[model samples]
Target chain A: MTEQLRESLSALMDDEATELELHRVLGELESDAALRQTWVRYQLARSAMGGQPVSHARLDISRSVSAAIAAEAGAETSRSSLRERWVRPLASLAVAASVTAVVVLGGQQLYQAGSLEGQSAPVAASGVSAVGFVNSLGAVPMRASYGAQAVPQLEPAARTAYRELARQRMYQYMQEHAEHAALNSPQGLIPFARVPQIEE
Target chain B: MKCVARQLASSVVCGLLFWAGGVAAQGPVCSEADAEALQWLARTVKSRSEVAYQGVVTLQRGDDMQVVQVARSLADGYSSEHLTRLTGQGAQVVRPHHPLNCTHPGEQLLTLGDRVEAGDCGLARYYRFEVGPGERIAGRQSVKLEIQPRDMYRYGFLLELDQDTALMLRASTLGRGGKILERFQFADLSYDEPLEPRSGMDTVHPAAHPHPDDPTAGARLSVPWIVSWLPNGFTATDAADPEGPRRTYTDGLAVFSVFLEQLPRELRPGEGLARLGSSLSYTRGMHLADQPVLVTVIGEVPVNTARMVADSIRVAR
Candidate 1:
């Protein structure tokens, strides 16, 4: 590029030029034969000074990126019919959101169920054990702690994410069950501790 | 010419992919025969839960004696007489209507929502279910089912269900490595028979007196040594009166009874272990400043299991 043109482009890159100054510089460089020649010369001079080979790679990258963007823009324009233009993409977004929602919702149920694995089975031991209550104490070995430690082995993030979702669902289910039971039970009210609020 | 051929080839491939995805998503449709078998199984299972059956269940720890008389009928869900070494010490709970006592804040019992309302899939909280082979139990064909623990936080269950009623004829708890921890079986079990009104009826009565008012109610409520950890499926299933004296924790499958009674002011730490038939018990003494705490954990698991459970008992302020 010419010295003036190169200087202006450098200023533009540095954000030192006004928008108009940039537009004018870029506009002039776009069509200016001498400016183009000078710009090429400057790049060649810089690379040569560093003992680097002239790179066609950078040129290829800019061309490819611009080409991809142009293709995407064309596709976007063609998607214009009522069904093709607006509805399809809109429907696609809805479907994506719905799928995500389903996963999160299902995950919530699984997590809630898993967390309560500790609590719900209270009846299994207390109420259901009517058939048999084992009081055998020493046959097993030291695996209790081994079991406790296993909770941490879960992928921490995934476990937490699922656990939170599960807990919320369990609370909702429990609330619904309790409400329904109360309505049907003659006692007027089923007494149990309020489901404790989850701390944020 | 090239573009047309490429389009045709791509369309064929896309069509095949869509066909496969559709097939994968469709669940197997249950035929009439399959549905009949399932219905029979459900009836059999419900009978086990609702019909009156009497049996002597021999519970063995590594080598302890914990036996009980269990009788249930659909009219009354379940009633049991927990056998104890002490002539009349074993505790009994009856659920003529609901198996759980809704009046108490026991575990998730507080969530006794409308029985009609469907609860979310809460099984994953405590179990990992695995489809098992079909087997035979009580002279009837049955399905071998496993309720595995997805995490170590809970114990696993291996159950044999009578094919006709889906009633669990046999069930056992397993450890982290899939070792059988305890088993509940029918020395003699039957279904649909009417239970004598006076035979085991009083045994199912709710503790006549509020547990709080009775001095013995708090007998094992506190222990000096607190449990450092509790597995995922375990919780304080029942707490008589933490302030009274005795408390208990259970994992729906195992029970750990804690006795927080007075000990010598200067008692030292030691392992107090006991085995009776299939039951195991552990006792230890600890102190909070000047007060001494004696804690005992009794269950069908190993001594270490009781110890670990006892070690996790802490006095919640």
Candidate 2:
């Protein structure tokens, strides 16, 4: 029991004690004289390490606080019973409010990130035929709006080259898909007709 | 007044009985009509390979349209088809037909001699077939058939067939909310016209080969990649190397292809989506075999389906 109290006292000294550990150390200090003396010594040592002056005499405030709590136990319990009725409901409401706030903030952050990326680096208009066809349809107004609003940021030439390479690869895959689809499809050459005519 | 009300109630009862009889008559007739329509579709598929015909077809997607002249000749159990784009810079494709084989399961299922078993194709299970109203197309009497998909994985199709020849005169791809995404219709057709062989015609500029990757010349080899998830009924159809490894999947009707290629060290891959007519392509950057690779999923499927396929690709252990 003494060893456990010592561990809790050490945790308290290091400011790493959990609420339960803190309570255990305080309770032990009120009951044990030797443990109290050891805690005082540790505090003095910590003070000396930081070049702070230490007093030899120490006040036992925990003893009085524990005595006062013991004396008021019945009345305090009655008062806390009354407070608990409203506190439980308020606690739940606070938890729900914080969760909602977190979700709203998270959604805002995502929107900001998307807009920032849209502004910082405009993707090159790849798939010319696709964009052209979609533009002609005028169905997705956001697609057209994006094209109009995109202000091309100063991107490195290498990035442009990379995009071109990617576009070429996409066209290659599309053509291959069309060819294979032509063979497998029961619709005959209709699959071939879906292949986008890449503009040089 | 009571006598008049009784007479009116009896008349109402007679009207409802007549309507009920009409509905009962319509039920069997509709199913019979659907069966007839399916038979016509089967006939269209069978005749496509065997019939010799010439026609001009117009392909339209969004605002883009192309006119193509198609000629087919069947001689001695062999068929040859030639297609020439009449509009834009002339591009022609000739598919020299060979003996039918299991290479094309779709075509094999449609072949008259080797028709698929009733449950093999499962067309009725996946799609609802209905005979729509008749219409005239290409100056020929035509019957419309609606092939509605039972699920979101496949797009619906509206087909207009020439009533006499049973040839598909027009086809439309239907999207969500019954939107027409693309249409292919015959502007002119003639079964009696003599198709002249244009063997030496060099007017074809061919579609642009903007990339060095020759998709047609890809070696048919399976790559060391596995798809962890796939939509129901989809099966891997083919895998080929077109500058990289490509895997194709199909659910009998709808199809998608996934291509994996290595990216240069300096190039950082980004994810994006592109839509062409009724088809969508989703692309993402992934690491496989300790190398950064670009994965692209292209198909006539919903965007989410393509994205799921792209996200599910992983290296096979």
Candidate 3:
């Protein structure tokens, strides 16, 4: 985290952070996981000093979760994993550590299609296109917003055909890259989000 | 009784623990095993192709939501999975297990340092690895592992690895200034034995996508296209492949590809930048001799950086 962002976080704790500074800190917190922990730490330190009875008695989930992971690692290497589904009630177990994780994914749609308003201003429509780069799930076809340069030279019918080809090529590239990345990095199948539709 | 008092007194101790956890490289060390999520991450990478599970995965990128039913199992020591999209036109892709030709990042680590152990790429040089709080996702307990990039050349990832299986259940790529570029999470996941692995699916639709390491590629050797500038750590991992109009690079975690294809016609389009979630495709068209050659850079890198990479490519004589 940058020193400027850290200062804003400190200011946020003192209730003296300006509106812009709050946004900046929150913005940094979203990208930087380290910043999120620092935010939590700052909050914990302030509350600890104020004697504001700590809601989370324990600070980290280091013991229980780590034990769960270590024990699972043992079960995994033993080759008996996934033979029986083990669904333990982790929520009730305040047994060892307390971790404050803010995963705001409470069943809300993450991004809104056509939210590409603040990007670069729309210039003249370029011939080379992005095929479909916006919030174009199925309903939202490629709008004119920051267009992914559709090759304008092709005839109407040919343009559609080219768009389909481009979409397929792009999807293939994404999946192929994902496949290689999954094999190369620690992020497993998380990279492959199932291929996008090619036939439209 | 002592435990209760310790809990109360833990408020003061929390401050010291916070500093130890925050200022240091790793996450707040809550337990000994969770000291660094790196070991678990190594396990996570190993567990991916080995785990057998069927799940409904939802992918969200810039308001673009796609849902797919995925069933993956170990077949001949690699992952053979069938994915049927639940959303859009229901397009499906079946990938039969085959020899993966890509080199592991750990294999690429030897060039960096001779002392590094196998399977360790020394990712800490680029990312601050941390273990986040445990959370439930896809109806199973998961451990949140954060991979924060130390540089701006690549994006960061927040992954949730299954506690029991170690398969990544959730991955969110963060970019565009701390906003989520794409979030892929399993809506529901099941690890019950005897998973329906590619038995009766119509696998005839889309043949396997061509692998970069496929030996049967018609092209024998690739022309060395000099990339003048690259983000500090990225190395050409695809150089050993059958020479094609493409090149791929990875800096241990992030990966990108450069494709320079020469077109027959003189009609060429202007430079354009398109994005699918955090992944991007930046196409630049230029005339190589009398013909136009389009050099496109594709991957999960920043637009400006990708554009710069595209700008830096030059065909070697």
Candidate 4:
């Protein structure tokens, strides 16, 4: 039976297996470690044949993703039921109010960093753990500056001005790089897409 | 019994053939044909300036995506390009066409043939080009060209060029472990379209042109600042800028610029790194000639590479 199941799994890898064989292979895959190993080997082999790079170690995140979804669902139900009782009769009004609230709150936070922190602090204080948000978002890891001998302290206003100056200079450099790349790169106008869309 | 034996024999044969095929497609094999591919790529570069086209392209970095509409035209060896953001705030930028003679020396080398040899040689040393399977993109058949970097200093690229026009349809920057750092692909494209006259397109024109008579023009200075180290195959391309004395370097593919500028007295010195899309900027504060100057290295390079370059700056004797 194991030999038959392995043959079926290999056939499924080739996409030549019948539906019955696929079902049989999937059913055995859960309890059979040897069968799972065979399935992985078959996948690796297929990728190799396609001339694609394959990662040796695989990290499956499906279980964690499912857990996150379940947690979100639970949170949503517990929070929304109370609101639903009061808001169901005035759905349109409530939606309009919520939309206005979001826009006003979002705009205010965009201009004020202190308010942004205050907004996030409640979530952190509530024990929801903002670290999961960062992980789920797959944010780029920040790199620390290398070879920093000393950091000079400055007044808050001066620090903000300095940061603004640095940002402007960086933007200038980025624009110059993009313009030069546009003229030089063999890839044609593709380089132009790299230019940041500076909003007025 | 006979039928079972026949089925087993066929399955065994199929598996053997599949395994053999896998073994054959291992890695890029260098050959004389690669030279031809290089020449073809060079021709494509030249053709970009001479040909006119319009396309809608999507740029993807991490989870962010932006769509841009681009139009290009070439007249009398001068190329003009207009790019508009299809998404976001609908920002439009129009770059006026400047004659080839008015362009900087580095830009000239790229357009002219002198740098082609250097570029080709550098390419040969630093990258391996492999021809991959053909696919259809934006309703056009494209051939995949895989450019694997010889070292970690530079990222690899997988480009799909239109088989007929040699125009690039899709390009992806591959990072360590073959992860795609960024991707640019044409959603739709048209080649050799009639050049449209600049009209009421809500365009943002540059305030002033860098004319030959301008003081900044032809002001290539021999700056005292120098980078102690650079990635392999990278060479300084342009002469130092007169304004900031910025230095630009390229490895025939990736490019980076170094800027040394004076900071305000009241401002405190800080070192930091930032990334926007695939481009990164690393800034460090240092004392140059008794004045506080910030050394910034900016490029579409890996963050560590940018930091390394920023840290490697020193005053030349």
Per-residue lDDT tens digits of candidate 4, residues B122-181? 254557778765689888998888888875567888888888777778888888678898
Model 2, span B1-317: residue lDDT tens: 13234334434443353344345432322244445555766777667655677888989888988887877776655566666666775456666643322134333223322222322333444467788766899889988888887644578888888887778789888986789888889888888643764554445323221111122454433446777767554555443343346777665457788877664431222345566677766665444554556677777776556645665666666
Error of 3 at B169 (Å): 1.2
TM-score of each: 0.40, 0.56, 0.54, 0.56
Task: Give each candidate's interface RMSD in Å.
Answer: 26.2, 17.2, 13.9, 14.8
- How high is the CA lDDT of each candidate model? 0.38, 0.54, 0.52, 0.53
Candidate 2, A115-168: lDDT as tens digits: 322322223333334312223212323435567332222123223333344345
Off by over 4 Å in 1: A1-200, B1-49, B55-70, B74-123, B150-154, B195-229, B275-278, B300-309, B312-316
Candidate with the larger lDDT of 1 and 4: 4
Q: List the residue pairs that clash in candidate 2.
A: none
Model 2: residues >4 Å from true position, as ranges? A1-170, A198-200, B1-38, B100-103, B108-121, B197-223, B239-244, B266-270
Candidate 1: give the TM-score of chain A: 0.22
Compute DockQ for each candidate against the true complex: 0.01, 0.06, 0.07, 0.06
Better of 1 and 3 by lDDT: 3
* Per-residue lDDT of A176 in model 4: 62
Number of clashes recorded per candidate: 73, 0, 16, 0
The total number of steric clashes, by the backbone 3 Å criterion, in model 3 comes to 16
Ranking by TM-score: 2, 4, 3, 1
